[model samples]
Target: MKGLIFVELMNFMEEQFGELLTDEVVDAAAIPGDAAFTTIGQYPSAYASRLIGAAADRSNASAAELCRAFGRYLFCRFEVRFPTMIQRYPSARSLLMHVEAHIHEEVRIIYPDARPPTVTALEVDDALHVVYRSDRPFAHIAYGLVDQCIASYGEQSTVEWCEGNDDSHARFIIRSLHRSAA
Candidate 1:
């Protein structure tokens, strides 16, 4: 994982939970180098899992839930950091459809060592089907990102997690709801 992710996670923890809780969580996780992260560096992915686990234990929230929330928060940060990439798409579905071929490609160009997940979106029966594949067990975070993306586009949609063959795979079905005249 890239250090940028760690830095963002730290920022998310501090902003949402507070500096005290963030410190406690980091201390509990016992990440190497005392949790000091540089945006351009790379670290063990396990550090991220441990931090999330510690935060979950302290906050009384499930790890999956925490990951999802973090994903949503992360998306907002991405929007602020990469406005041009986000602005190119008019809707969440549009952005998702090109995540793998475009966005992730751009990410790889900027952060050569970054290992991002494979996100592919397909349109079927008027709904968007997003497939997420990664060695890391962070599908819930992807779900959260998709959820927030839809909401950010001012679109009415429900995101559902479909079955996956294993931990490394997940499918999300996003269906837009059409509202009738009042």
Candidate 2:
């Protein structure tokens, strides 16, 4: 993780946890009650806290390398129904599988040319799941995901639409809602 993200994490922890960190900050913040649960701290249990919310070197590090790092992190966290298809891009795509319908569309709106997931009844979970990268040009997706979800749904949704690129290569699920009976 970059020094900035580490520092920001510290400040974020203090703001959310009601106190600044110290020797026991790790334990106190990592506890189930801390606001850290809402941030990158959620992944520390799996050793992913090292790389969850930092920028790769614009100096030398490539996006693919960063995506791979993120992939490794998420693959260890989420239980994928289609692991093979998703195993390739855990950091970038897998986290998107559980998004709610309308919020997913709002996330797409964040990207100018981005589209939402094609809606499907599927085996279960009729909700929409869209993948919009969070960093780079698509960084606005993060702003959209959080803002729109709060606007359309409520302030309680924890779903995040963050990724590692700016250019829009968005994927969405578009399905019509109607009555179908035998």
Candidate 3:
């Protein structure tokens, strides 16, 4: 977890979720990212801040351990209210329970503050419509992944190439993925 992410998430609470938040909860939530932030992940700083918040509470419990416990609690079930998550994940705590993705450095720069869209489904037609935006680029890299995920999971589906979007995404379909224009 990053201080930036925690702060940004906190700021987003007011802006997007219409809620007041505490630093302690955010701090307790930052441990899982400690091992591979820059090399393999993007939220180390935020995790660190979360740990600091956790550490402040108990002398017997380390922030890391507290965070581990928090992680367990998060996955078990808690009400975390965030307005923008479409009512599925009600808060940051709840969002933490469900969403898990590795950020792409290329797109992360443009939407660094944003979390990747989790793919509940991929509806592919002339365009690649992803249930989770983070799963969008995979539409090009391997349509089979989308096919397997959605069809196997019973989502309406197809895999076809589209044009536009600064070529950031479409280019992948054409250049590396051998996708034909629709």
| Candidate 1 error regions (>4 Å) | 164-167, 179-182
Clashes of each: 0, 15, 19
TM-score-sorted candidate list, best first: 1, 3, 2
Q: Relative to the unseen true structure, what is the C-alpha lDDT of residue 56 in candidate 3, on a scale of 0 to 100?
A: 36
Candidate 3 lDDT tens digits, 53-149: 4443533554433333333332222123222332453322223233333222323464556444343322234333433233223222123333332
Give candidate 3's whole-model lDDT: 0.34
Per-residue alpha-carbon lDDT of model 2 for 101-168, expressed as tens digits? 43335445644334433322122253344545432333233334323323322223323343443334
TM-score winner between candidates 1 and 2: 1
lDDT of 2 at 31: 33
Candidate 2 lDDT at 91 equals: 33
**Shift of residue 154 alpha carbon in model 3, Å:** 26
Best by lDDT: 1
Query: Is 1 or 2 the stronger prediction by lDDT?
Result: 1
Q: After TM-score superposition, what is the CA distance of residue 130 in candidate 3 from its true location, in Å?
A: 21
Local error of candidate 1 at residue 134 (angstroms): 0.4
Over 4 Å off in model 2, which ranges?
Answer: 1-61, 79-98, 102-169, 172-182
Query: What TM-score would every model get versus the actual structure?
Result: 0.94, 0.23, 0.24
